[model samples]
Target: MSDIRPKYKGSLLRPMKALSFLFREPATLPMEPREASEVYRGFHLNDWEKCIGCGTCGEICDNFAIRMVEIPDLPSDPAKGVKARRPAIDYGRCCWCALCVDICPTGSLSMSREYIHVSRDLDSYLILPDEAGMHGENFLKGWAKSETSDLLDLARQAMGELEPEARSDNFDEVTKGFDAQSALLEASRCIQCGMCHEACPAHMHAPEYIRAIWDGDMERAVEEIYRTNPFPQVCGRICTHRCESACSIGRRGDPVAIRWLKRFAMDQVEPQKVQEIALKNKVSKPTGKKVAVIGAGPAGLTAAFDLAKLGHSVCVYEARPEPGGMMRYGIPEYRLPYDRLDADI
Candidate 1:
């Protein structure tokens, strides 16, 4: 017989691979209420004690699936990183990306394997996640932050500063702020969540402005800052940054130096450039709407700035010789120098 004929000696038993499917469970299970996979991002579990209610999750969520809800009993403290508010996940909108978990400052968020929920009540879909599961059944964690996939840049960019030897000798500004490459790298750490805005007393548009800064549109960012705040110089320097405290990144990593970034952007553009940009938004024709805004503080100045931009005849009367009311008097020159304040005016 030919040697080729012997090579075709097929096994009489045939391959057993096809038989395995009959014994195995299907990957896509029936929708008739079953447990999720070990790593299925089914639902959220939040530790109330660990969550600061900064709402960074809501801000970074591309789907707008999360909201910060007020829980009356929850204590609110900025320094300790606590908020009376807590994140409420809307299952209707959650994409199960687990970005919130990765960005949570306190690492209080996680996903659970137990996933089935059946109810006619739409309200049930909206849950203020706590340590307990959706049905109060604390299940094993599903989608959690993995070392490789965690999005938070825990370490802050080392801000360039005057050397201790050099700094001690003078009253010069200590921080040199970020350069072009540094600012871009640092800004990338931000998740564009408005948690910083919510935490701020002035409610500055941090996300929008930071985005502008990231895009290298310092002029646009300066304009955005001027939208809600007239004292960018003051805020960039001396304001108590509730924004940094509530920063979602701060939960696990160094919060973005939002104040410094703002200062950097303001510093990048010349005063005349800022004035030109500001004038673009100014109503030049004059509406003749006379609005008398009281005080020259951030609130008052912000109001006056808006009114002035809106074509209204606005005059801000201040008791102090300076334009900035409390900021000029209360804040130290070391923190916010008079020159920067003058630039803002």
Candidate 2:
């Protein structure tokens, strides 16, 4: 019978076969860094020129990886809602969520395609990113803020008003003002950034009052309104709302109806209640000072209100039958009703 087992013959050339390919070129190409996708969430990039430094990004950061760093050299204009600060990101805690980019009111924050950040220094991980990338290199932007990705409700709640035809005959106010439901909806849109407060000529506590209105506390809203301005009804109806112009939310969408919200709060609370709230902190002891202000316009009345609150004898003199300055005489009755003006006075 033939032997079933095969003869064992070891090849001497097997060990040398592995060395033959060592001199030959590799089949795979050299490993080079590949470009990331267009929308890759990578390192943060901020346009310092466009950034208002509202810190909305830092506030929305769930991981607390962002902080506002004050830069003294940066222009700080509160009336324009610009702060002299910028966001500093701690990459170690950041999850690359791109939420800051989506919620940035000015659309200044974005991510870069270049994500390769290797460093031996621990301080390098926390950086205040600007227009330049991590290494001060110009990189393609990725994961930028788009209309679809914006978290802010840009469109403002439409306010109801009297039709032009319906009010053509009478001198009643044109704007019907915001109702309770509309007021709450409008007030809820405020991010409480205090931009409105800074922008307001009177520096009214708009954020506080708006929050109060959102919380369904009309009295509290009135109290907040009266903290700075003596005439809520007047300003609510006739005064130009510069606060709206400086509103952070207005960067992309219609600004919060600050004027309308103020009107709503004033309308909801009774005049007596507002007076009580306004005078709550008035000085108990009389100052025994006499202040006589000529003209019963807004300016004069405001001065009188302050003087009276300080426990002084205050009197206002007016030439016309009524005193509202341009608010009553110059402005049309359709825009500002006399009754509301009277209530403010």
Candidate 3:
């Protein structure tokens, strides 16, 4: 076979053409940093003041690059659901997905436009960012949370309740408790952030119970509820739920139905079963100690309950016909049914 391709004819001038560019100006731009895109996913920037230390960012990070570090000097208020911790980012493992910023309930986490960080020290790659950039220099905000970018289910499930006209005729409980389906749907909304647990006065294990409820284990949910609270039925009905206020979801949307979820769990279990669960941890041996509680109100009864559980003999005195203090004598029956209060007592 004959080759049709032509052979190349080399030129002496072509070899010298390469040297012509050396005399001309260089084509490449200067090696200096330039502005990045407005919404570029770059280094992290956290507003420590706005961050509640929910650790949602750490939980959502697929690479496990975010870690919550305790800052001893930072203020912590359990009632407000604030923690003395901050997130530290490991750039080596980060993918710059911006998911941490989108899921942040407080909108305190965002990416900065300045992304360059060149260092020989390995520890410099990991940083606890504040408003300043990676090098402690101010940078423009990059990707951040917006209504369209939020990943949380802000709107909670609608609660079932009796119509005003229907409730006007009788003193029956106006708010109908959640059904199994609605309860599960509502429980799924929780991120298990533990914010509610800190905000609760009893320090109730809300995240544990909510997860149990979502898993469809009514008995386990009930058990978790009774761990810190003895009066589930009463508290579920009328106690002020500070936990809801501290709910991370409530920052952008309606908070989870924590109070109603408690009521639902209590309603699902039998009264006898609830009583058994509540007393499951009571001391088997009597301590032979006798204690007298002045009143049979919530506080006094709680004291008595604790005392009795510790194998101590406790006696409660009540001036009124019933032992519920303001919960019984003050709150209307329509709001809190007497039968429910009795079950709690």
RMSD of model 3 against the true structure: 7.5
Q: Rate the local accuracy (lDDT) of all candidates.
A: 0.80, 0.88, 0.91
Ranking by TM-score: 2, 3, 1
TM-scores for all predictions? 0.70, 0.84, 0.84
lDDT for each residue of candidate 1 in 296-321, tens digit (9 for 90 to 100): 87678878878888899998888777
Q: Pick the candidate with the highest lDDT.
A: 3
Better of 2 and 3 by lDDT: 3
Model 3 TM: 0.84
Candidate 1, pairs of clashing residues? 105-251, 105-252
- Local error of candidate 2 at residue 337 (angstroms): 1.0
Candidate 2 lDDT at 137 equals: 89
Q: Using TM-score as the measure, name the better of candidate 2 and candidate 3.
A: 2
Per-residue lDDT of candidate 2, residues 294-320 (tens digit): 988778888999889989998888999
- Which residues of candidate 3, in runs, are more than 4 Å off? 1-39, 71-75, 137-140, 146-149
Better of 1 and 2 by lDDT: 2
List model 3 lDDT by residue over 1-345, tens digit each.
Answer: 999999988997788878877889868876688889999898999999899999999999999999999999999987777899999999999999999999998899999998888789999999999998798888999999988998888888887789989988899988888899999989988989999998998999999999999998889999999899988888888879999988988877888999999999999999899899989999999999899999988899999998899999999989998899988999999889999999999
| TM-score, predicted candidate 1 vs. hidden true structure | 0.70
